[model samples]
Target: MTDNENLKTTPLDSLHRELGGKMVPFAGYAMPVQYPAGILKEHAQTRTQAGLFDVSHMGQARLTGADPATAFETLVPGDIAGLGAGRMRYTMFTNEAGGILDDLMATNMGDHLFLVVNAACKEADFAHIESGLGDRARLEILTDRALLALQGPAAATVLARFAFAAATMPFMSAAEMDIGGISCLVTRSGYTGEDGYEISIPAAEAEKIARLLLAEVEVAPVGLGARDSLRLEAGLCLYGSDIDTQTTPVEAGLTWAIGKRRREEGGFPGADVIIGQIRGGVSRKRVGILPEGRAPARAHTEITDADGSVIGEVTSGGFGPTIERPIAMGYVAVGSSLPGTRVNLVVRGKALPGAVVRMPFVEQRYYRG
Candidate 1:
């Protein structure tokens, strides 16, 4: 556990406090859990309008070399070599045993590849990259920057007011643009599964950019609480909870992230194991779980079958504000992973009826074009 006194603060820390954000320790940083509007209201605000988030705690870095993409592919299973310029791909680093190390975003920025890693795993992730690549690419950690996410249905309109071109960028594409007169690397992507952009800005100007976005009528200052619920409703994985070093991509329902070429011609770490799983299938698979009652199943909640047999456990669970019901994601025996398969959640040592269901409890509203 990170000591509260040693926790770091983001560039938008002051603004968060000014907006009555309730700060809490997260990933070794003092991040806001929610604002005065509360989690429920904030969650609705993002779905209906727009929500601004401070994601500066995430690690940002640049990898540059003669052929960074080809070199990068040596570490992740994603098709980094095939990633087009200004396009982004979501991929993960795996261990020798095929367990996920951490998931990350790799953006092909023309001359170099830009990476955004989870805050909790940055230090070790960077070291792993350096050791694995071994001078094949130069890693430049961008410590003097901040990341902001403007998410929701109205996010495009809110951002368009400052940079009209940003509103037209295709989903998963990135570009260098000026927003409110500050230079930023804007990507039409977000964790909420909404039409939004993740803006990377200079640390010193982060507050200015944040304030400008918040000044918009449809924009509200959101915190980590709503962010979690939003991603959950979207059926996205939360690194430490939904996925971990003990979980493989195949088991986590992320086999889609492994590029076809990489799958056929394996070379990256754990390729042998992951490819084998892809071919033969795995014993367990991640699936969406919808508890029948209002009682929300939480992480580590024991999951059982109708016959009172333990099958798996919930990895992430909560009451989805948008769905207005209890939803969860967990790994179950492959036979029980089918949608509509009846299951039981052992909450408080009592059996609670639930069933397997298709995910994305809320429709992903990304603007594909």
Candidate 2:
């Protein structure tokens, strides 16, 4: 537990405490790391049932302009101009050298673009977006908003009870709806690689909405610890850890998020460098790792070859409860990145044998169509 004196508290701060949440400092907020249910059980509950996560600390904003999509494309490589109404695109703000500033979700909200950025990077992200696209549009941060994610196989079943239309939303879709008469902007997506919805509601109504979802037997209140394990198992990147100002999309295994048109036309930031990487290939790449035995490898662990010479380092690693194995993700030499390629992770001065494996150690259950 960090000094809570200067930390920011979310709208449901008290509610979380009452629920027996082990509060900790995360991204400048006093947030729950796990609850009385514990991280292991909470994580298992999410995979088998549903998990409710309070993501209000994340930055939400709207960009309005004569043509928001066209104006916004200048900052990212994604084809925002092609983003359809009610559709969401995962993209990043690349620097002039093609390094990722931050990864974000941009939803086409017809009149404007609604965006969600990482909590830790929100301030810088907002400032960058403003400097890059402000002249072309109006950037308004949603300070009064609270975001909630309900994810798992039973997510739709529970959300549908509040808003029937929620059950019909396909993956990567967003809509403005009234869930149990509570106004919200819902997105049929999640970081857990599970079929779920992210609901953005008024800050004043956050507690009310969270209470409603927790009241359902299918849903359990999940904390940051479980959220981290769940996302890692899904092979999702965490900003500042897996990616940063020094990492490009090509090196991060996120080139897929860069649209085909953007790659061909070469317009966004660092177009020359990124496009070159797309065609010429990168020296190293982000890869999934599976360490043998029970000891879990953690971030910053050195990766080495058969000869014990250093090659790369683990970015995120831990025991994945869903897969019941020690799962990890890291950047390794391209040749050493193939699945089954033997590698070693230096943990606590001891080199642990491991191998490069396909991502999503636990198979993803994202809803399609």
lDDT of 1 by residue, 214-238 (tens): 8899999999999999999999999
Worst 10 residues of 2 by lDDT: 1-10
Model 1 residue 289 lDDT score:
96
**Model 2 C-alpha lDDT per residue in residues 1-369, reported as the tens digit of each score:** 357899998998999999999999999999999999999999998999999999999999999999988888999998889988899999999999999999999999999999999999999988988888767999999999999999999999999999988998989999998976889999999988788999999999999999999999999999999999999999999999999988999999999999999999978899899999999999999999999989999999999999988889999999999899889999999989899999999999999999999998888898885
Positional deviation of 133 in candidate 1, in angstroms? 0.7
Query: How far off is residue 225 in model 1, in Å?
Result: 0.5
lDDT of each: 0.95, 0.93
Cα error, candidate 2, residue 29 (Å): 0.7
Clashes in each model (backbone N, CA, C under 3 Å)? 0, 0
Cα-based TM-score, every candidate: 0.99, 0.99
